[model samples]
Target: MEKVTREEEIDEIEKIRMTLGAHLEELRRRVVYSIIAIVLCFVFCWFFKVQILDIAKKPHRFAMGKAGLSSELQVLSYQEGFYAYMKLCFITSVFIAYPFVIYQIWQFVRAGLYKKEKKYILLFLPISYLAFVVGGVFGYFLLIPFGLQFLIGILGPGIQPIITMQQYVSFVFMLTVALGLVFQLPLVMLLLSKIGIVSPDKFIAWRKYAILVIFIIAAIVTPPDPFTQTMTAVPMIILYELGILIARPTKKGFILLGTAVGCGAIAVVGVYFYFTHRGGEINVSNPYGDIQILYPGDRGWKKVSGHMSFQKGITLKTGKGGRTVLSTKKGVNVGMDTNTEAHFFDSWKMQLKTGQILISMKESEIPLEVDTPNGRIRMNKGTLNIQAKDIVTIVTAVNGEATLLIEGEEKKLLEGRQHKMSIGGEPVDIGAIINWSEGIVTKSDEQK
Candidate 1:
């Protein structure tokens, strides 16, 4: 009887050893599959980069203004635009194909876990997806809007808001992703605690420490500003506290003691970077490198090396000689009187409804002409001759000065201002053409 019992025990021990060995092989196989999938997905994303860029820019096109209002503006350098959009594409491809990735991970880990644990983890798959989506939603719908509005509102008056498509898109996406990951804290804690990694008592004891760190994180994630930083920080702190509760293990101690404190400190540093500008006093510079069209709602900018001439908008129109209408508009509205010189011609043609107007001035080089049916604007500079007659006209300047000629005679309009001198023209009581480049300034929610 003793010998029979000994043989049975040996058999049972061997069975257990073989199970573990089998599990390890399964794990290796699944990991290999996951790596292969990611590589394939990344390669695919690279091939279709242009298509990916269009999607990433969708949010900016919608939020910046109406689609017909302006052309898409890229905030980064030429290289930056190419790379940033690629990064966006890679991230999106990974996310969209994440389910397959997760499934591969599960197949490897599944066999090692008991049936009950496997079932429970399977539930986590969907929950993880939900958490990610929720995080992104919180960022796009809530955090970004508030932050953007706050930055713009601060500009108040005397500023032209020129936000680039690249900057705008990147900023919104960053906030969305950061907030989404932050929202997944509870799930992360639950998993860690369930695995005997962290104990409940340890979490309760370190609650205060976690609270301090949460504020720090909030500061880092938000755009730098008292209103935005504090708002972002508070929620993060709350989430951290919630994380502790979720992670609390009744029997064991905490595991990520350092991670908790470290992430918190990082948050604070990020917030600090956001708010303080030019010795901690706020001054607006172009966030879009050399482009100075930063609107009132944007955050303070770093001192860019040089000026950025942001392409606010571009329009191709068919006129007598062909008009290239551009601004933050589909086309610029020009107004002029036949008697007006370059000075009066340079005055921005008011949207006439909104207080805003278009300022147009000529360059000394690129040859151009201005003529319309309204009154007319006459200007003379260098080798240019500007003439208008039929009705009132708005003049668009390229890079030359026009010799002002009115009613078959000649007169001095005014001198040309340097820069892409876009000044408003005077509109008749008849009204201004609703061109693409101008609008009445309006305040957004964050500014409020």
Candidate 2:
């Protein structure tokens, strides 16, 4: 009898190996399918690459609208050009192929689950996908724009602001993926709960720890502004609470809807504030930096100092004082002083923080670039219309007849006939135009 039992045990072991082999084969097949699908999607995305990039730029576009401005931001590399589209394609493909990938994952594990539990795993596929996409949208739509605007607007005049596509794309990618994954907390916790691996009671008990984690996560994910970080943390905390609340309850699908509605309301308010206030952050990398204070009605410029590190874009060119123009992969803060002649530029960026940027152009021929049309340069004056992408050209006419040379055809924008008085010793707009790039800015009288 003992011999017979041993033989039977060996047979059972062999059968288990066979089952494992079958499952492994299925996993391999699924992986191949996923790879193929991703490749196909990426190729397809490459076709409509421009469109994808346009979508990625919407946040910046929205922020620029307040000043009736548009930017013709350029990418420096040839091979790495069209980077935004590449990022969009990659991200979109992951999402597009997720359902199939999840199905494959489920198939690999389903044999181990009892018939009763298999459906839950299958259902989780869509839930996880939806939650992530929603989170990504929320972040892109609400938080990123405001954070960018606040930081950029703070860098005021004597600095010609320039941003690269690489940094922007990376930012969008990180935020979208991070937020999408985070938003899946409830579903993930629910699954663990149903499996008896995690108890709702225990989760509630350890809520404080969770809050700390949320704060840390908020800091990691949001831009380095306390305001933006706090805003994100509050929502995440609220979401955690909602997850806890729902973790205990009956089969109420409406719970998610209610939670979503509340989240939506908060997001709406956040969006409104972001648009109404924040404009864009500045990237400054200057050694000999100075600030300027220009009032609506003043005479000359003053030199005030500033504190900025770098969000992005540092050149190799030595300053007149010979300083390194550093670039930031994340962003760094450096401290410097700026003189007062830069007030006009600074004030332009600062007006966004308070709401609208109001500066009377007076009787002068300043070059103006409008995003609404190509080569639409003008001697901008009289309550100049502003909107997202409205101002893309440079306004350059300290003297009479601001000649706009766009698209090979120079249009005499505003006839250069009058010189507007320089507002000297005007209070500097702290959160306005403070950036330092080579060439884009002519030396301010105050800097001299």
Candidate 3:
């Protein structure tokens, strides 16, 4: 009997060793597959590395343009650009190969899971990739643009920023990857719940603690600024709430999740329409002395009061000693000076028939086109003063940049500079040009 027991023990030991060896082999195969995917992606990405770099540089360029600075990334050393390009291509490869790599990992691990466990994993595999992509898109579109704008332009103007290629690339890559990983909060919770480790009730009970930890993580992941940290933490808190909702595996939980998702989709659609449509009108405020608007087909100009809106093809006129402001949904602010006459062609284009107009754009992606008798001025993002007379047009770039086209000639106007159409360009005092618009105050400005 003792010999029989010894033989059984030996058999059990040999079976366990064989199982372990098989698992190791599977892991090796998965690793090889992942490496091959990454290598293939890297080679493809390397050929278009310049275009990738340009895409990465877009946010930085936008921030610099908004801040009225040059949009050039500096290189500290000769080899720095080469290494940065390599790193950039590698990061791009990882991003492209992430789904395939996850699939390889999933294949290796699925064999060890029970039927129920495998079902849950399979359900979450695509969802995990989708969440990661959403996180990356959020970082790229919203966070990077606004975060870099705040960070780079927080000091105001007059300070030139010399961001190095290595540092910039590292910052962007780290932030993107961190956000992508952080977005896995809900999946982690679902997995824990499926495994009987933690329940939805526990997640709800620990909400306060989780929020605290989320803020801490946001502070670590984002730049050391309240704006960026708050932006990151808010989304994390929302994800935490979502995790709690998803942790419940009952029918009621699914119904609640569906309702919440439906509401979110409606809200997003509503916001999109609000910005894109905006009733095809520009808002008017800060009517001082006398400000009047003439509709597209109106024969007479009507006096404007506290707040009003003008449709396209309407003409706005300011009497002597009068000033007012026109604002669009796209962040274009047009301040009409005393005795100014301008025609509101549309949301993005205006015709300055005569007098001076002060235009201040706040992070507007759409270009503002102002037509004058002498030339046409096009600016995507800037603060400038335009004076149109009978034969000549004067443009003073108080902040940011502008482009002037006249008589088949195009000129670039930089900040703190003045360009007289048909004449030339020269440096000017921004304060002098923008001082008149200071007196025109809207309710929001008054509250400020």
Off by over 4 Å in 3: 1-18, 249-448
lDDT of 3 by residue, 1-56 (tens): 97787677667555544377887888898999999999999999999999999999
Task: Give the per-residue lDDT of model 2 (tens digit) for 1-448.
Answer: 9778767766755565546677678778888988998898888888877787788887775544332333335577885566656777887778677777777777667655644466767777788889888988877887777666665556633355566777777887788888888888888777778777888888778889998999899889878778677667766766666666666874443565477558767876876765674432333344453333222222444432443332212111122232222222223121221211111122122211111111224443433332222243343443232111223323334334444435555555353332221123224555455544332356664476
The weakest ten consecutive residues by lDDT in model 1 span 343-352
lDDT of 2: 0.55
**For candidate 2, what is the TM-score?**
0.57
In model 1, where do residues sit more than 4 Å from their true spots? 1-32, 39-55, 58-63, 66-71, 75-78, 114-116, 158-170, 238-448
**Model 2, stretches more than 4 Å misplaced?**
1-20, 67-69, 82-84, 250-271, 277-448
Lowest lDDT 10-residue stretch of candidate 2: 349-358
Which candidate tops lDDT? 3
Number of the candidate with higher TM-score, 1 or 2: 2
Decide which is better by lDDT, 1 or 3. Answer: 3
What is the Å distance of residue 107 in model 1 from its true position?
2.7
